[model samples]
Target: MRNTLLVLLFMAVNTISYSQNQFTGIVKDAENGEPVFSANVYFPTLEKGDITGEDGRFEIGNLPAGNYKLVISSIGYTSYTTEINIPAEEFEILLTPSAIEMEEVIVSTPFHQLQSENVMKVERESISELNKNGAVTLSDGITQIAGVESVTTGTGIGKPVIRGLSSNRVLVYTQGIRLENQQYGEEHGLGISSMGIGSVEVIKGPASLLYGSDAIGGVLYLNPELYASSGETNGELRTDYFTNTRGYQSSLMAKTSGEKLKFLARGSIAAHSDYKTGNYERVTNTRFSEKDLKAGIGFQDQKYKADLRYNFNRSEIGIPEEIGIQSTRKLPLLPNQVIDNHVLSLDNKFYFKNSSLDFRVGYQFNDRKEFEEHHEHEEDHEEGEEHEEEHETHEEDEDHEHEHEEHEGPALEMHLETLNYNLKYNLPKIGNFEIITGVQGMYQTNDNFGEEILIPNAETFDFGIYTTAHYHISNWDFQGGLRFDHRDLQTEQTLSEGQLIEGIDRSFNSVNGAFGVKYKFGEKFTGRLNLASGFRAPNLSELTSYGTHHGANRFEIGNPDLDNEQNFQVDLALEYRNQHFEVFANAFRNSISNYIFINPTGEEIDGEAVFEYDQQNAMLYGGEAGIHIHPHPLDWLHLESSFQTVTGELENGGYLPLIPANSLTNTFRVELENIGRNLVSSYSFIRLRSVFDQNNPGSFETETPGYSLLSAGIGTGVKLDEFMLDLRLSGNNLLNESYISHLSRLKPDGIQNIGRNIMLSATISL
Candidate 1:
């Protein structure tokens, strides 16, 4: 690993070249004069590049002293290309918006724009951000956003969690289309990758107002390559090699566009051997490898644009089980898992004189195969490796592995399909008003069950219609939405002590909505209020699942008679921003009626440990506050800080699992540019983060402790006439502080986190 880092660092310093003549200008909205940020300014053949800033200013620093064709493009805008000469001084250029006689453009302010009351945008480094495991995942990108967390099984598998919900509570939309798969498994991380993403936006609260169910926790939007104003093309090639895990990851993406059409394609592959925790102990018992592929085609003249996309992924992992004692230590034996998933989607958009429309339809299929056998497994408790001593002693005293039965795997198959339609109209005749409406339908079929306990093949169908309207009167923007859903669920579960008995039937219908208002306080601050309602039907797997999940080492059970859960939420946010500073504070409280819950009773039914699912009245509530500072004070330094806390409990005072409590993150950034005139250099940032102990009450499982983790990184980029390069070296847990995260099942009794590690990554544009 150390040698790999040295090599990457050497490459960073070796890739320097002479300069080229430069052309520079600022691009803004023709109507509003708002700067178009991060607009791609490119010369494709030369592989040269520049990006517009927050002020919409772009400058190609080194132009190889010549007349060159330049292309520029931005989303929701027209493309422009022309020939220009790079003299000594920067020149100002203006471009016009694409004209197709379409509706009033609703400009998406970078990342959540922070421009409008109805929409919130967050812009930051997603593709460039690395994870604790040293390799980046889309899931890692979401950690920076408030009200977001990951249900991680290991460094390789982290599922997004919104609000106080995970699993089906949150929805993922990539390129304006929904993604569905059987993600309940531990290794489902293989299902998606962040290869070519430009940015990620998270809607932190109830969003049934627009996206329908599953938005209960919120929504994650992963957008593709942002187009430049010119008619050229865009692309990137990034390769990351990690030392601690002894693996490599590579990604490549490309896109091309003309006046009427745009197309994009990307592929990625990551492979790693087992990684070690602190010391020389290998925490991961599996050797894992994953591959991802995605392609998209889009068509547009002026009034309409349609997109078709397909994604495929596959992974294989060794599921190691301890079967015997090797001198008082449990010995790991060969056991394995194989998983594969495929998704295909189509989305269409149309723009008229005063309205914009989007339609989405998709299907996803998955097949998982698993194998496991005799092993005595116990949780390590949400604490570090303090339990290793006990594990070693027990192995020496008892015959733990040879007595258990060999666990056989199952044949798993699932298919889910969704069809959706949405339209937003900016009613010019109705003054300042925008109305958004949509309807979505989904049908899913699955054959997932155990031989002893059969949950017959089942199918579910759901349809929903929703509408949202934004009305602005003076400084106040009032927004509200209403949604209605009809659901039909058929569960096939045979009840038989001997002969087969027919399965039962069930169904449900629900209504959800939200009302919100934002009051602008001058140009620097805004206060917003939202009152929302959300509902979730019991998922097929949640209702009919029955089996053993060896990853967590626990027998599982499910109930088919569970009812739907409904919730009411109230949230308030205050935001202030200006040229060099930004501050945001948010608060919310949610009350759930008929909350569905799973309980483990330390009791076993027959030979399998029986866990039951039931409904109860519960209350979930929490809030977060953030403050950022990027003052012009030094021109060479920047700092930012944020804090968040949350808590929840059952009606009977039982504590909810996995509630994040009081956390803090602080970051400092400094840079130096225009070095020796030919070079622009910068040192990005250093961050400190920590999480407090979880003491929210009822948890028979275990508890999590407060621990502090330190991380630091530095990077530099070089620009040549036709080539550019970037490099970064990062380290985490420098103190080797031992701690356990709440979501880690192994932290309760298995292996702890990897102690200390460093990584270096590089990107090259050809």
Candidate 2:
């Protein structure tokens, strides 16, 4: 890893002759041919972009000689996207004036098409937009999107659930590489921070054809922040304060871009005290603190481009049991977790006139430690004991050993390391057909370091190969793909004073495929149909665990004979849009064979309930529908409503565990182009969120009642001389509702979620 880092740094500093190719264009309004100033013109593939000048002219120099997708966008006007060849003649681009939101390129899927042109129905959200909606964390923000939910242990730890599946089922990608950080654990949160993230794209259904195993449920793709434009240097400072947790977050970012090299760095820190409930009672030991640093460097020439990104994150989070303490403490107490993660990724692209090759590699190291309250055992010695000298010597040795054991080491510790690589080749376009073939895989190893072990030391190896294609004909788009994956798992045998365990070696193979069609019905309606298959191999814990998992408060037993889980899903989506209104609906039904889950055995081990891994057939169905309205005459006023629901059931009977309740959300918003003399833009919004009752509980699970929450926020951008400042004030749970989420791990203890929270944030651009 050290050698690789040095090589990457050397490449970033080395320079070559610049290419003479340059692209220039002018952006104008379609209605009156008026120049559109300050419009963003970008090439997603090259990681290069330019802003239109006052005269609407933009120039991008030193571009590789190849075909690239060009996107031009500005506020209050429809975005323009098209395929353009480098070194082509200068041209004029016209954008239509519209009230609808501008479309962004979808990076999760192949072809990198806009959502409107994608065959798959993907949800995309920007970090800035999520923050404006009063989201406290990246996971909390994603719940605002339809068809998505989270299994939360607290505000600091959350596992994303897509369409009722979570844990090892959903795969997360960052910086163009797979993120492998012990995701099999439900208490593990998404380690990637939102500080340097530009946006997030979600693939809601089976994506095995694109990602491989573990993507049977879906995928979360996080795009990193873009580098500064050529010859530009920029800096930003952002800060936020929250009332409920007495939490504060701050970040500093700086970037500079040369003609051939670009570099960026960001540092962020956050700390929060125990959160309070609606009754103003603090949840003891729920405090958390985080520190993060992200950096990136990129170098490009005529034929090749390379980008290297690195992130290091450290977090200390407390585990709340019964809410005993009432003080606002920022540091976590015993029964807490300390985690450190390091992620490094390097992406390289080779451009060849009509085709391109992309190679990406990533390395991740995760160190997780859990500390539990310690108790000392007392031994009594009789006054008139025989062999007094021997007894004294034994007691002295025992005391020394006890002293060493009391040195404050973690009760449980694990180190996970992963190395993954991806290679894709874009074939030359044949008429209207475009195809891409890729190979993706990873090698991982997990080691135990502490006194307690939830899972034995194990090694995993994965290899996959896939091919996908896209074709455009008339008003219809067709896409299909096929993939094959193989995984190998091996564990070491261990023998203890009271227990004997045998090691096992297992191998699994799977073949998956996906097909989809998208059609445009005239100018206002669009429809899509998709069918896909996916699979996931059993994780280490599911195959070798034999002890208690303190994080979940249960003793678990693994099943080494578990089979691979395979699933098939069918999805349908429809959309209607016009000058005043936009509506969309998405539906999906999934069937799985050999679905794996943990079942209570009605047994106890050492005072803890025992659970064992089991497998059964299951089915899941869900849909999401939403509408946005901007009255023609009152474009500043907007009304939006959305509803999402999903149900999961075992083949024999009962419902699946951790399923999210049906939810509905409505928002009323008003936008002002200019609020005052210094305020250039402003917006305010109020939202009502409702969760319906969840009576369909799985085995050992109880029913949960529904609840409603009210929230509102206002934000504005202020212009001061040549600098820009953004300010926002938001409140969540304004009604102070005392409610518990169906997927909350703390719900069984009758603990309510965080109550009314007021947040104030500001960002200054220099």
Candidate 3:
């Protein structure tokens, strides 16, 4: 039955009628009035796109008679999008130089358009800007975005929290594929590194209509670096240093592009010692080191395009323990972890006479292992005497003794493999509407080879189908979509010493949808309203786990009869902008049915508290507001401030766990000129951030006090004839204020946050 339906869908997508309305355009640079060659020109409604030739001209011959959304973009330039009528005369499009916050190209949505043209708003940040914040990890840098926070175990490991949701509820995409790295655990951090990435795109609300399951909270999209300009080759070397942890990082990248082919490569390495707290004391076993490499090759022509890429990451991270003595060690002691991740993907785009299609496939492998120290009882022995020699070597002598005596191997090891596939088609223009239909899925398996087991071996399969559309009118944009998904999971019955542990087979299905509209009130104001539904299937750890959680120091038991979680949310946003000032606000409310969470039972298992996974009805609501001002007399002086807050509560009265505290931040910046020879565009800024006390406590949760931090930074760029150099110096937590974050996993132990530290970074490009 499924095969028959798929065949019909393919047949409908391939059937198209050609048209005769031709549209021609020329692209040029706005600053210098020069032709911009190799620029991209596209029409989303017509499903037609092409790249400019040497003369910066492109012609699409088969566009139907209708209103279309046309976009033109090039490297190092802001994207331009406008509504146009078919059968029109030739037009000219001008591209401006990229600014600090340029108009971004929206991904994760079916249609590609500029942020202003998109019906649903998205948050974007450049990699260069994130680096300037003195962030040591990708997860840490993203916290700078309003309404976003990070749950940290230490300086080296953390996870992203969107509003009041995190862990498996949040989804991450890299290399155009979902990342799977056993993320349900409190100690598991995001596996991908920030090196070689171009930018980050975030959808702060549910996006299940496009991304399917596990997108109940939000989506974090990482875009890879763009290919070099036609017939261009470039290379860069970057390095950074951190004073608090005595850490260093370095990376190198090279890329080249030709008329029909392109290639790129990047490699990076980072190492850090144990971090120091605000009290001037070192936290034991908090050090970590990482190595990452990425490479890609691509080929494109008039009708076809294909790209292949690969990424590899390895990390050696230490697990903190209160029993260990304080010391500034560069390597972990006894209990530590070694993890490696590899990903390979292939993306292909095919263009027909009046339509286009895209197909992507990816494979990922993750290997994780944990090592623990083995204790031995004291025994009296003669000096230099050997009393451990066996008289006769038996078949199981060494193996039996090692298991019962002193063992020297990994305490737990797990290997995970996943394969993903996606197929999407854009239908030809029909009136003033553009429609997209697609299918996406994944097949995965997990296996363990260790004495201690956390989750049983399991196999998971998922499938989803969706259809989305966009309509553009005079001053209004409309978007809506519907999606259906199903997930099937099976686990082998666990057995230990002739005792049964857990086994399960279950299937979950859901139907979700979204509708949104954006209206331009005038040239200086805009408004948007969106309503969406999302769902999430239970993860392996939440359904079959049965072990001791070393990081939380507790016993965890999973419920096999758990059901899927469903959510519905409404988002409203408003913005007002002009030459001197800009302000924006976003408000949202989300209600969930059958929300899954772990709760303490007031019971003990083997001298540790027992926590069980359970379901409950919950609600969350929040809002974020910000403003930016640049004085008229002092154009170079800039001021910005923002506030974010969220409240989560169960249906009855109790609050939810792991909710972030409200925060407010203010910044003052000024531009400088004539600093030195060959130097231009020098700038500096001072920032203050205050976190409010978390008084709304959940069951078994405690209240946390508030704290304030002050920071500052300065940076500049220098031009050499054939080489360019960039330098920055930043001071974080300059006040060295002692504080504990409510979302920190180590808060129970009274571990203070990082101390005052200095950071330096430099980049040389050729």
Candidate 4:
């Protein structure tokens, strides 16, 4: 691992080179051919950008020979994007007046196109809209998206499930880097705060050609807040409160930019008490708290760009068991967790005459500790029997050592470190085609420092190379790509009871590809069809775990010879849009070979049931449909409805576990424009969601009952001179309905989901 880090660092330093490539352009207003000054010009793919001078002229040099996307934007103009071939000497660009809301741009995929222009369809949501739904956590907010669900252990721990797959099947990307925080664990959460994020994008099908392994289900890409415009400074303060858990959250952010330099900083704190059920009964030991901080800086010139960012997060969460006494205590009892995470990233881009080169490196560290009560046996708890013989015997008995301090430290502690690297080159365009080639890799290590051992100490190395292309012809776009990946894993040897336990050393490789096309039937209709193949290497836990899992109260045995799980999927999407109405539908089918899962052995080990990891062929299919309409006479009144369904089954027979039940949701929203004397904008909405009963459950899984939930919210924004004040009030399950979610891990414990949550938040921007 050390050698790998050194090599990556060396490459980052040596990748820079001086070239004669140069690009120059002039920006002007579309309505009037007047020069637009100080406009920001950038290349999302290359990460090299510049600001137009006072004369509306910009120049960048040392560019590599390649095809790139150039984005131009200003404070009062709509963002403009177009494909640029580097060798061109000078060019002219125009910006139009900013519309009420411009089409969102997606950065997760390589295309970097607007939502309406991309060959593949992706779902997007802004942070403000996510908060309007009154969710307590980031994962909770994401569940509002159709076809997306979360697997929850408690109120504070959640793992995203896409198209009925999760736990090492779904991938998460943040800060332009992959997140590696022991995602294979069921109790592990996303470990990210939504404060510093600007928006989120989701791809509902296989994306392995873009993001290596574990993208079989999908990818969740988080886009950080953009820096303030050139020569401008801005800041915001916000606070929130939730009644269900008595939680409070606060955050502050500041950003500034200059001609060639930019910087940003943010901090947030949150705390919550135990959550209450529909019957107003407290579920004890469900409390959690978090502290997060982030900072970033960047420097840009005509030909070179460099940016660095770091984030630190600390969280303390409690694990819930049987219902205990209802209390408002802030601290939890025994059986809790302390997690700390740190991420650092650097992005560099170099521009040549007709192409560009990009290099990104990231380092992440995660420390997780689980604490539980340690009870001593009667013989070991002896005290006050101070006879000379007894004292001598106790002193000589090695087993009695540290008997009084058994409960002082955590029962299980694991530290994980990961380093990731990527190098990509944008090849010069060929006729009407754009091409990209890249190499991605990672090196990781995990070590245990406590009594409990879930998985053995291990080291993993991964590498992949891919090539993708986009071809444009009239009103149709074509995209396809292929990738090859290899992974090697090794675990340290261990001994139990003076007997050697076999060590594992293995390697796996695979080939994957994707092809997709987008066609515009007319001005108001578009359609997309994509077919992709993805794979997931057996995780460390599935291959090396051999011990008691305290969180699940079971003994687990791993299969050292487990092979990679490969999947092939087909996705179809259709959409129609006009001024006042829009509708969309997405459908997909996936087949997997060697799907890894735990199987009950019908045996007991030291009073705990034994389960072993195994493999089987599986299939999944699902679709989501939705429509939004605004009546002509009452444009302020909006109506929307959506339905989502998915099912997974083994090739032989039974269904899969943790599959979300078929569900439908509807919303009625009203836009309050000029309703108050000082209000600039305001809105209110109500939603009715229904979940159908899950009659088809996997093996060892029971059926779930159907239920309906009601929720509503109101928000307004007031402007005072140059400052703005925003306030929102929202409620979930207003009727306090008692229901159990089919995807909740707590279902087996007979615990109902949280109910009747009232949230209030305020924000002030300057």
Candidate 5:
């Protein structure tokens, strides 16, 4: 009888075990047949799942033995689901396009437009690219998103341009604060830098509602890393040493978590003397060096959480000092150009049962100093000999006269101080209806004491308030926002005549807004229509400036009576995603009223050509589309490719200046696992880039030619360990291409980029 009881017990245990079963599978792209790495695989019944590893492999243990449904998803791709009967062994699965079911969901939206219904596009194109500058900081990264172009400086600075709008027409924000820096002047374009950003979000079109003025081009939001609710912290330390570039950089970041408090701290140090050209020649001051540091701390609870952050950045960079003789120009890339920044912010999130509040207040101060030695050209020329007689040799003779030693005409020190505050709230009063309102105020001052032009001192005050609403009703999503701005500027200057031009004041007030509606069909498809109106009051530098533009090597003259430039935009977007693939397309048209532009009057007034700032009606239009095919057939690697183009026309039908031509970027990455003791390898399989030259050269501009660049990266044998290493090998203008960028100086010809170079990087965790 005991033996019979034991048999019955064993049977009962087996029956219970049989109730649960395990499921395993591999995922791949349908078109290219590549394995999907890091693809999300989830089971509704299980409520948890694992991501695909290299070789497109995934295994889920301890699943109940029964019928189940599975979901797969990835960014920039479609989400997919399938039903299966699970036994025990591994199974291979495929996902279909989400477009079929999306057509019925045209009434749904993830976020609402702030104004009237119009089409718009939002993109995160820099997530996996190797070149960080082109992705997150300033405008360089957004240039690859269709209808976008970037105003590129040196290796370190860049800004985005949408359609044909640039400068004051663009609005760039970090997290949500309208970043403060002198973007209006190329000189200050490199001032506000983004060293460590997680992602860059781009919204193309007018964004006057939630964001005030200067949003005529588009909006670029820099997203930072956040702590999780579990109170678990994670971080990384990276160090890179490059040869041809002759630089060493080290970065450290840490995060800590607890039930109620979490914090993050990051610091980086980098210094490099100079860079070498393709011929292996040192490129002097072209090699600027510096150090950066950032820190943040926060606390979270079931209802609310708050964080505090402080950032300190100090650097001494190389600012090319160029001189022109006759028709040839030579830039001495060896001098040190110094600039530094410090910022402190307090941010908080308040949560209630059905609503939430997010707020941030911060203070920023930027101090900049520029010094240059005027190199005597040692040469002079007369106008057309016929005109020479009219011009006379007296003017030419004085030009060649011996010059006295001077400190860059006179040392000019500029100071900018800003105070900012903002608050946004979400309410559950109307179920899916939400509203956000906030205000921002700033005070900026510029002091100049130079012996040369002795530009007077200036001060600027800016204030604005904005509101936005989001409503979701059934299959449709609606969004809209409106903003009002008030600006006051004061300037004082002394002319060559020794007369004091004192206390010039200007003020402007305007309103801008955007509205859009989103529709969702079933689950796989989405479509949006958006229309927006925005404006930008003339900036301080635009209205009252007497300085030299170093990069373009031009003597800029600011227009004091300039009126506010206005923007109107319309955008259309379509999204189709599922499983291993996602395809997106965006198109837009923008029109500007009183669009400000630098027009060459040809007549040289005083010592420089009357290249005065002027305004005219303008228009811009363009579109871009892309597709993501993960794990085409391969299971251990990933590939992403994109291309963008733009076109702009002045009301007079003239093409805009300094507009970037067509460009393309392609990246390949590979990740490994389990070489030995959880060791893994991360590698950049390949990177390819191509840029078209700006053949639409201006009167003072020289034509440029298109070129291509190729690069590759390889890492150490193990990545899973606390320490990982990477080596990068690259060649810019690989063909030894001698092509000048659109922003090159206007002389006989233009300068070229570094010929070729190599670099290596490493990261560690504790």
Candidate 6:
């Protein structure tokens, strides 16, 4: 009789476990009792999801038995979120209609939370939304967000500047890993493609508590395109054309997903000729081209999920000089760069009864080459003529000939390889408190293989450990984290211009922390206050460089005794939102110790101005404010306005260099849904931007005049039987404004920014 009881108990346990693996839910409109079809029901932590069918029913199976956060979202409705336990009764979700934009998940933070619930005020924008604003490139698109700007060399090269800091201060992440492409140089571009990117999240302040070194200023996190819904297959083809540069862009993407397996692939190519300025003069050697490919595969079961992704990109960018040539050539001329990059990453997650573990590993390889025009000197020819008689009788001349052949090739070539990993454990939630602990590290190497070496060959190793927690009580949320990091850098001595440059080995350590609080006032107001500290170790160029940077037209000298840069920043944000109106303001103050910068030494080397790296204490303060309005009855109309300002100064006396001028933007937009039988949606918009004069210039910089620009765009989506077509027409600098941006690298040469450019784009979905 005892044996019989044991068998019955085991059978009951198995039945319970099987029942807990599946869940069902139904979605309906809150106002009416009608089903809401195509609503997305997802469990983010579990990596499990399903879409509601026509009858508003969704069922997800093969889930581990645990308490999970359930989210139900649909267009034109407010998203619903709640905590659910396995084996619970069926859920009936009611969604309320809303005119405001839907909230998105913030992935850059340790805890993935909705934007409305996050302690930090992160800015997020979709790639499609940026493209609709007539952005010519990814770096250009980010400038549309307040408190963000770009240092542009020309139409082909740009670097992102957050607040008033740039270069190695800001960190960029893609494919779940930090991007390393020798970002210390001002002439280097972002080295990222816009195709296959879903959205971008910007952390406006110090994020070293989450991402260790090099995040003293901020971070830019890019999210890849998601897989298709389960049991669905989709494909798309897109094309774009620009008039100012005679540019062409084309891309293709396909994705398929099953219950346990998913796959996606995308390929894109872009080419452009020299861009014309407002005066109809084309800048010489400003053309550029790019090719990119992205692929990903994922698998998930009851307790584990794994995803693997790969990206390959190649770019050919021209180094713009004086306005000399007028040809509309697609290929870049001499004094250009060729860069190839490859990235691979693997992400894995394991689920337990009440907790989870995540492991991610990424590898990246970058190959860069620069080609410059080779000039022959008359003295060298005369010497060669004298040696011609001896060359015919000596075998050493053959070696000299081979050396000459090599010198005709690329002037600079460098290879960089990086490997990084992250392991995080999410502790089981205790009531309304959650915690996570993680370890992150990276190993990288840089090698030079050309005639010119901008930086000596070096290797670097990094390790960091951190823990973060979040607590919720009443209408308040609190978050804080602490991190410790260590780095070891080693370099090989080399010769530059017959000088023996000494090599060095060094190690650095740092400890950083962050704390933030969010409070809700009534139902329409929210406030956030955050304090964070960050640090950055000096990079290779700052420590070892001793060469002329042809791209920047300057000779650089490095300082090997530079110390680590540390900073502290305090940020405050206030937001008020309702059904028809929204307003937000963000303010921040940052103070830094050992702030590094470049200054002219009043010397010349190889016909280039000499500059040396130095450090001092600095301070920067900025604020951004924006407002959105949509009248009660005129919900289709939107009026938006925003203003951004920042100022930087050295503690000793002078203003900081490269600070963007204050700017204001105003936009008017109209949107319509389902205008006709074949028309799915349509939108039209016009925007005006004004930049205030920058009278307070750095000691070594010149002042810039103020300017204004106008832009307009129109777009529509059409349904044709089994396919959907999207079309857009946009124009930038519509009034042909002749002005130079304060951050333009070519401003000293009296070069005007691109103007009067029109773009047409089309996409077909199947």
Cand. 6 Cα-lDDT: 0.88
Rank the models by lDDT, top first: 6, 2, 4, 3, 1, 5
Per-model CA lDDT versus the true structure = 0.61, 0.87, 0.82, 0.84, 0.58, 0.88
Question: How many pairs in model 4 have backbone atoms within 3 A of each other, for residues 3 or more apart or on separate chains, i.e. clashes?
Answer: 12
Q: Tell me how far the alpha carbon of residue 500 in candidate 5 is from the true structure, in angstroms, after superposition.
A: 3.6
Across residues 469-549, which tens digit of lDDT does each residue of candidate 3 receive? Answer: 999888899999999999999999996334477678899999999999999998779999999999999998888767677
In the range 688-716, model 4's lDDT, one tens digit per residue, is 99999999987867999999999999999
TM-scores, all candidates, are 0.78, 0.93, 0.88, 0.88, 0.75, 0.93
lDDT of 1 by residue, 447-498 (tens): 6443344234767777888776767787887778788987787766455335
Instruction: State the displacement of the C-alpha of residue 333, model 6, in Å, after optimal TM-score superposition.
Output: 0.8
Tens digits of per-residue lDDT for model 2, 490-583 = 9898542245567889999999999999999998999999999999999988987788788899888888899999999999999999978999
User: What's the lDDT for residue 142 in model 1?
Assistant: 73
Candidate 5 regions with alpha-carbon error over 4 angstroms? 1-120, 125-149, 192-194, 227-235, 277-283, 321-336, 374-410, 449-456, 493-499, 547-552, 605-608, 631-639, 666-677, 715-736, 744-749
Q: For every model in order, what is the number of clashing pairs? A: 32, 0, 0, 12, 60, 0
N/CA/C clash count, model 1: 32
After superposing all C-alphas onto the true structure, candidate 6 shows an RMSD in angstroms of: 7.6
Error of 2 at 497 (Å): 9.4
lDDT of 5 by residue, 1-766 (tens): 8368446744543454333345678888776678877777765433335578888878765454444446676532355665455564686755433321111100111222211122345555433242422122334445545566656544445566766566667777664466675567654454443446555666677766656667777776665554432334577777666554556667778888665566777787766544444443333344455567777776654334577877777656555432221111111222334567777778666543434556667777776655554564334442221222343344344323312222334244555666666666554435566666767666667665444342356677878887777776767887788888988888775562344444578898998878887887766678887888988888766666555554445556777889988878888877766545667777778888998888666765445555667888887777776766555444346566777666677887667776666777776756444446544544445667788776765445556787777755555445545555443343333344444466532223344555555555555655
- Say which prediction, candidate 5 or candidate 6, comes out ahead on lDDT: 6
Off by over 4 Å in 1: 1-125, 129-135, 184-187, 227-230, 318-336, 374-429, 448-456, 495-502, 606-608, 671-681
Off by over 4 Å in 3: 1-79, 83-91, 94-100, 323-326, 376-407, 496-499, 633-635, 671-677
Compose the digit string of candidate 6's lDDT tens values, residues 131-225: 99878889989999889899998887888889999989999999889998888878888788898999999999999988999999999899998
lDDT comparing candidate 1 with the true structure: 0.61
